[model samples]
Target: MATPSLQDGIDKSGSPIELLWQPNAEPWLPEVVDREFTGWRQEQAAWHEGVALLNLSHHMFDMWIEGPDATRVLADHGVNNFEKFAIGQAKQYVPVTRDGNIVTDGILAREGENKYLLSGIPAAQHWVQYHAEKGGYDVAFETDPSSAFRPGGGDPKLFRYQIQGPLAAELVQRAFGGPLPETKFFHFTAVTLNGRPLRALRHGMAGQAGFEFIGDWEHAAYVHETFLKVGEPLGLVQVGARAYATPSVESGWIPSPVPGIYTDPELADYRAWLPLFGIEGKRPLNGSYFSADIEDYYVSPFELGYGKLIHFGHDFVGRDALLAAKGSETLRKKVTLVLDPFDVRRVIGEDQDPGFVLSYARHRVESGDGLVGVTMQAASIDPVGSVLALSLVDAEHATPGTEVTVVWGEHPGSGAASEADLGFPRIRATVQAAPFNEHARTLYRRDR
Candidate 1:
């Protein structure tokens, strides 16, 4: 029997928007680990003051791409500069549609000779795999779906753990019993802890100096235990799923954007290859920013503050269109919105959600001038002590401290004016610079 594809599901749903705007079984992070170890608030502060252990083994999808033409397959699809990508380095790989609309972004690391691993959401993997198969590239892929979609309840192929915060380096060195290797920002080095081989990527999701340790599943327990024991005195707290969702809120990374794959006639074949059960086929498009046109939800990479990653020197998918979009005044600028405290008391009450539903809703952001932007992901960050919302708005309103309003209720059918219903109806907000953490914005990217 032929496997159901995204195209089949969309056909039955009537439109791509209908296929996308349905209930989803997968929320951002599944409950593989406890939602909290000590308390969400304490876990939230760990990464800021001391160190944090993040169990990322279950939530993200990983795809291993290898073979003679692996690099070619990536170069033909991604907008990142290949000349600078070397073994032990990584990039925030951004893939786009032929029209230059963003498909999604993933962390792509060059792990071996002519081999790479792309990790994060499934959107980029699906896109790259389809193109590779169609182009007949001499490349192969082995996928490890996030625990939510992994078949059977068996163990994952790899285990990923991240030690983050200002004191992450101290924790890592102490655990390793030696001075850590000199690693550049976004670069990784092979290291052995308790005689088990692992790759430690210098990454900072919290916008702090940190290391993401990736290794074989067999050695996962050893690494976890070693870190827990070694990091106890240093005030390391294990971050649960509850607090895990808030890191990106302060880091300025927008994790989800509607991929621009659906509704494009040119991508019909691509859609047919996408599984009906995959994230692309079934993820819910909740929130107030709605249009019958699926294209309305599509975002350009430039709009999400990824213009620097687009390498014009390379000819790839969406190159010509992106070249045209480079300086266009219509592109939206991503910013941080600090929800008003007075309105919080009046609307949703004092106990704002601590990222319980981070990227689920697409709330509408407006100004007195009229509709200006859309809030992508929002959460109550303890460190910031504000309900920070990541939004994309007009250039004119992108400045810090610009007053705006957020309609806090979900529209009935997720359409613009479907209906009004929620705990809170409206809340006022102020535009601010993204990466609300100064270290994240300035010093986090530096390799000291």
Candidate 2:
């Protein structure tokens, strides 16, 4: 069977939110290069011990926006400030609905005066493309979807590789045969590797010192092999998708959120313009936090811990809503919830039972009688010795020691089981700091 493209599966009979949670639908899985290379345990340990090379070329979609009005178009549509966004600088690109809810976010890299590269989150790319086409912006866009999901398993426009850890800098230095360039966080610089020029972005997903190397797709093999040859003596381990996902849990970055464009009647035109088989239609929402009203699923930048990225210096889509949310007493803060060891053990133990499945789906979080928040990403990191989840909770329950309950197990309505039997398992959880790993917070971005 041929693989489905982003526009192949459209169910316009219902809202996008409703379609995502449709009963008996297939569970959503991220497109990855390889599920596992060595093993998740050893790959997870590589980031802390020596170094890990992660192949990011297959999972993310890359979009290039170039022209005179690219910056203006982005500023008008997104919530981020581009005043100081220099040629080589990059930032967490965030776009929101008119009501100030998050549409989608990803990494935005300014390649030149009128050239920008936006990678990740296809929804965000579509949103940008929609606005640029109709908003009368003098911008042209070229989108390159992930290789795994793209037709015919073709090569991507660029091959992205991340080398991260305590020794990542040393490896880069050795690869270049000299000192590494002075690149600040979220910044990129040009470098020569094997006589081929490439751009190195000073960024790390695992909360460690690292550089993301990006160049023409043709150089992918040479660049990858060169790193392996130079990094063999330094104990470099190639990471797989299994371990690549664990870092986000420790770093407190929420990977997925329901796009906010569903419920708003004002966005009906945009919805109609979108193809049927895109991320909105295909991505399934599983977990314990099932809601009839789609608005309940909407999240603001403040709730996602992106308050620092919002600046009122420029007029943008969600500026007013964000301004009001900033000063409001009712603020939802993002925090890490540490699952009780015993509860975790119970969930794991249940896996042995017949007809039972263990899911890492986001669950509903409760404080007392009220549903305070919802957990986003959950994972078990062996190094941390605890199963951690990223959650957005009310300010009252955002403290480190505040106790809460995470409703684990898949709900029957979520299509994991028949409707007659709903298996709702409540697990004890304690609220902790956002970044569960202290090293990720303190040393990830430090200059060595």
Candidate 3:
């Protein structure tokens, strides 16, 4: 077990940046699963024109909070308004530091009056669990870390499956042998399939109509095998771990933003609680953006699209600081950078496989005379035929059709000589809506 603590890790590295900038940082892909099913590119295209069945059972961790104070415990730390958070509805839960910088975000669903399931990256769960324990809240917390860290290294507590793409609804309806509930976005309902009940939430990746089903882990194998049998003929392709990471590029959600837990005196106790090998201490960084002060890498929720989700009607942990940052002219706006196809051919080369080029890649986004933004999660979608990178740039540079240049490559002195062999490549890109795909931006949640 990688023992010690995050504080010790940081102390040994001399600084947080030094600890994070490891040589050839590993891609943040799910463990215990094939990187591809049919092929990542084909799997990606399936979600665009046909249907994609993503096996999410192995990746995300889960936390169960139940008790009289469960709701209040979450309400105090979360930015999303909880007054009307209904029993079966889910929201994009965001928590920020005392200074209002984002800690992390996750999908929080209210399962009962005093029962909730908070699941996603471990950073957010750890933050909430730490507070729940220390604050004397009347809540019982249970964690089911992803299979990656589960003690037995067996099945997880729950199984998550997502059906998405153009024919998603039709395929699922066919499987049900009837009509699906006219569920709104982020809303879930108990649906029966093969005499089994599961929670089906209306959501998607890469901005398409989809449903994500969650249920006991015991049902995973049967449900998956049954779905694959029934869905294959309907153009349903199974998406694997490698291709699953690209959805954020098209869906516009930034995965694994550096948690705002380090360097905050308020979070000193948290660092002490975190293990050195845990996600926070071990999550490495790549890309062109490098700063000695790790705080420079931190971002606010406003920089991302979550600004619209923030509610001020009730007080929360970072309420005062967040209140002050509201509508600050300096905050960067999230945008998608469509890397030039020609430049991609020249720099990445014709033989470069698009489906596998992933990292904590941060490319510098420059607007003519000055640096305006940083690009993250650059990906080459099979359907889009061009590499699209989600970036946060100055508001003026965020307008669609604005031209910018991305200095593509990893940070200097951080890795293998092959990375250097790729050479310093600059590619031209255009600024567009955070979701580069039109379907995601216009029609995804339009019905809601």
lDDT of 1: 0.85
Give the candidate number with the greatest lDDT.
1
For residues 141-200, what per-residue lDDT tens digits would candidate 3 score against the true structure?
Answer: 888988888887888888999999989988898888976888988998999888888999
Clashes of 1: 1
TM-score per prediction, in order, is 0.95, 0.91, 0.95
Residue pairs of candidate 3 with colliding backbone atoms: none
Clashing pairs in 2: 6-277, 6-278, 7-277, 9-276, 9-277, 10-276
Task: Write candidate 2's Cα lDDT for 1-448 as tens digits.
Answer: 6544322333433444446664334433346567667777788888877899999888899999999999999899888889989999999999988888898788999999999999996888999999888888999999898865687777899999999988998898889998776888889899888788899998776577789999999999999999999999999899877678778877877777778877676776777777656777667776777765667778888888788788789998878888877856676888989888777777755533111122346578887656888888777776666678888888888989999998775554433422222456778999999877787777766752
Better of 1 and 2 by TM-score: 1
Against the true structure, candidate 1 reaches a TM-score of 0.95
lDDT of 1 by residue, 123-212 (tens): 999999999999999999999899888898778899999998888989998999986788888888899997899998887876777889
CA RMSD per model (angstroms):
2.3, 3.7, 2.7
Q: Between candidates 1 and 3, which one is better according to lDDT?
A: 1
Off by over 4 Å in 3: 350-355, 413-423
Clashing pairs in 1: 287-362
